[model samples]
Target chain A: MNHDAYPDSYIRGILNSVKTIAMVGISPNTSRPSYFVFKYLLGRGYRMIPVNPGQAGKDILGQAFYAKLSDIPEPIDMVDIFRASEHVMPIVQEALTLKPKPQVIWMQLTIRDDAAALLAEQAGIKVVMNRCPKIEYGRLSTEISWIGVNSRTLSSKRAQILGKGVQRMGLGTPKD
Target chain B: MADAERVPGFATLAIHAGAKPDPTTGARITPIYQTASFVFDDVDHAASLFGLQAFGNIYTRIGNPTCAVLEERVAALEGGTAGLAVASGHAAQVVVMHALMTPGDEFVASKKLYGGSINQFNHSYKNFGWNVVWADPDDIASFEKAMTPKTKAIFIESIANPGGVITDIEAVSKIARKAGVPLIVDNTLATPYLCKPFDYGANIVVHSLTKFLGGHGNSIGGMIVDGGNFNWTRKGQYPMLSEPRPEYSGIVLAETFGNFAFAIACRVLGLRDLGPALSPFNAFLIINGIETLPLRMQRHSDNALAVSEWLSKRPEVLWVSYPGLAGDKYNALAKKYVPKGCGAVFTFGLKGGHEAGVKLVSNVKLFSHLANIGDTRSLIIHPASTTHKQLSDAQKVQAGAGPDVVRLSIGLEDKDDIIADLEEGLTAA
Candidate 1:
């Protein structure tokens, strides 16, 4: 599903503000889509919260890796998972139980379970099937740099990317 | 200590721990005499009653048989030498602080604490010339750095509010002991089951009976428990305890009451003068709440653990901040101190920041959006917009609250149902 599918500014506005998200399950081994998608999201400035309990408690891309979601104590807003369908159940349960429950639960690029989705949906929790928060953040809110021209215009003309507009953000807000 | 003596198991002692069927009247349940004045046998008996020569109740306001039983029960629950029941938790603080420090003394406190404490320290106490020094508990040196000759006590919450961060009570208590001061802990968040502050080297423990202790959310009251650990007569430190009380005809509290009785002195003298006595009705409600505390606390912990686990996996979730979660920074501390169970109140961030945060709050059906914590029913609140709204952006961040932050006081609900309601809120967020 793309951003324009819902005209409700509520969901759209949310999708716009979120950028780099730490997908807890990004695999360093390139065979995994998590690795490629993670690279793409990192290239998009969204931080990933690593959650491979084994490889967690280490560092990835100079960012501290956590064994689980709760390990990253400072600040984290979104959790994108690349685990399994059954795995999503416990993950969803844990996520809703968070002090501030996550804004959206996207069930990866292929793994979709209506039962899990409905559970999250019932909690007034948002769910996206077969979608990635990293990819969406990159695609929906792209005021991209480089190539010197308007990326939104370029993506519209060349790739037909379906977002509204690009406004420069996260830069130069302070004054002396 | 014997098995039966080790705090007398919560339920058994909450009712029978303090009173033993008043010998004068073999009544089954404790009774309130309700009389303001007590008759003396003769003029010598009257002099002794007022002059500390007799051990009988003379006036209801000064001392009551019913209030004494309530005090004993609270003291047993807290595992302190004695306990004092006050008009409110705020009053308990006032009374205790008055007993420990004089007009120009100071106390140190943690930065991540209740907002009311910050206000009381900065505003109300300032008028009374009592100074409060803020220290970052995370940086142990800040506490030591803030200490001075005038410093009298080190204050902290066993578990902080809203943030759910646990203080290293033993470590802070050590610092206080080294500095010749008492460690005062607000045990409101952790409650007695989750943590016994007295057991962790705290010299005094205070509680707002409004929260978890009164489990059913029925009353407003406060209690103060003296650990009977601090020695007031050792040196020329505490003037109030070592010296004389002018109103009580020059009676030194430490000399008159000995160890366990200083807490009672704070009641008979301090609370009596300050006039912040707890009502019998509130005490009754608190007693009712204390009976099922263990059961309710267990349910609250289990539900919170389930909710925290679900929150970590959601795509739209920004971050989850509960200590029970494996990777959480506080997880190790939780295991060390709160091994039995971590309380349910905690905070998490929404994926979409503010708009999503609003959606999250508006979406949840089962989670009530209210300000109070430790309720049987689950409640949620947005910190940046509500409770800490008065603080500046920097202050909000200092208080560990962000614009996107949502606090959930998970209640005794089915785990799946709680998650289901959270899902709806996350969708809205």
Candidate 2:
């Protein structure tokens, strides 16, 4: 997959299909960007499993933290890397070693490594670089645009509201 | 195949940015979520919301589903990070200042502003211990001269009210940058359709939705769009965003919210406490008005330019202060900023002075003799006798509301009909 620019549909497809996301390098500090993203995705009803070696035994927003991707007991649909580019190759390599390999490897904003992305693509795992899943989710769902950030995607279709008052848009199908 | 991405155009976002068909009822329009409060799923849900760990509506006073749509739509149009909707344009100003200023802090503002705003800054804001230092928008150096250590923000209008003067936003924004202060632009007259302040380097954009954005002049509302460009955390100057809030479990808004921290600060700290919330019904009306914003604003601008050209040639008119006119003083700035015509509102001087100004307003048949602008029907007001009545003689002239000045908010009426009505008013004057 080309990392230059991902189409709205492509990003949306990954967002909707992924039920469980393992966010690596998430911090315990509430003010950190990773913590905020983890919290936001959790609020969006995604099953978030935080991966931080420093806080492996503790929980973040009530979700268990794992020391590494291989240590995660449950299957992860996607591995969201919040660490720097230098640390990404090892994480992607470790993700490849899992019994049921993660379907996608997503690098957070400003963390892009073409070599790791190529390796993941060679392994048949979809790769996204230099993007924030929280921002992408908000943009595709038209949630971020509400506050004025330009969400390049535009649709006249009504937003889908799940149980409770939460509103969400699905990427896999246009009907959502 | 990797398909090329197509970003939505202005009109598309105006209609669909913050809206979707109702989730439960499948309502085609955004419904008015009129309730004062929202229900929580459980104890943890309530705790998470109260702790600012979640993004969900808690009280109508802070956020509502309807107002959220309006906020989002306006924010999207302005290309800002986020927006916060409030009760009125004045409320937006107050909320923004509340976030940026402590008691005894000062903000430098342009003298060429809506008269009511001048009064608000001069009088009402004083009670809050916020000081306003006036500067001439025409003199770029005055903005720099007015700044002090106490200066927390710099405010100006994208287009001055009544006079239709265009501000040199980029120049002022540079001064604001030098002072390490956020520049707030009142985009009420120009609207995002004509002049997006964010694009011109304004850190924040405020609007009175009662005017063009609502289009009909029916409901009164306000909005504060955060450009998300300012570093609120730098030097810890703005404690409201940089400091940990005692209310929200010591959450540093600037660090957590990132680009949109200013908007979040205004909503949670300013609006939450100050208590100036926009009604859901008003939000719905503004949203509807915005759907046709691009269309209405274009027609409004076209009509105003034609009317201004005609008025400039009339014997009854001493001078027309429309930037759309070729030889006008701010014409160059207007071309640079609002290349889409000079907007609907402009002031023209009457040869007969203040009495004639009042007479023209009274004699107009089609134009409504009201203080408001940006209506579908042409509206006229002699600021010296109406909106700017409270200001002194010097202030009146400085604000472009001199005794001879007659402000016209040219509407969507046919150019001939609007011209005819103005001619009759001019004849009577």
Question: Once model 1 is optimally superposed onto the true structure by TM-score, how far is the C-alpha of residue B410 displaced, in angstroms?
Answer: 2.0
Q: List the residue pairs that clash in candidate 2.
A: A146-B72, A147-B82, A148-B75, A158-B21
lDDT of 2 by residue, B298-411 (tens): 999999999999998998889988999998999999889999888999988988998898888889899999879888989988889987788899978877889999888989
* Residue-level lDDT for B370 in candidate 2: 83
lDDT per residue as tens, model 2, A3-57? 9888776787898888899999998988567887898788777899999999989
Give the count of colliding residue pairs in each prediction.
57, 4
- Which 10-residue window in model 1 chain B sums to the lowest lDDT? B1-10
* lDDT to native, each model: 0.70, 0.86
Off by over 4 Å in 2: A1-5, A29-36, A39-47, A60-63, A73-75, A84-100, A109-124, A142-152, A163-176, B1-4
User: Candidate 2: lDDT of B21?
Assistant: 70
Residue B278's lDDT in candidate 2: 95
Best by TM-score: 2
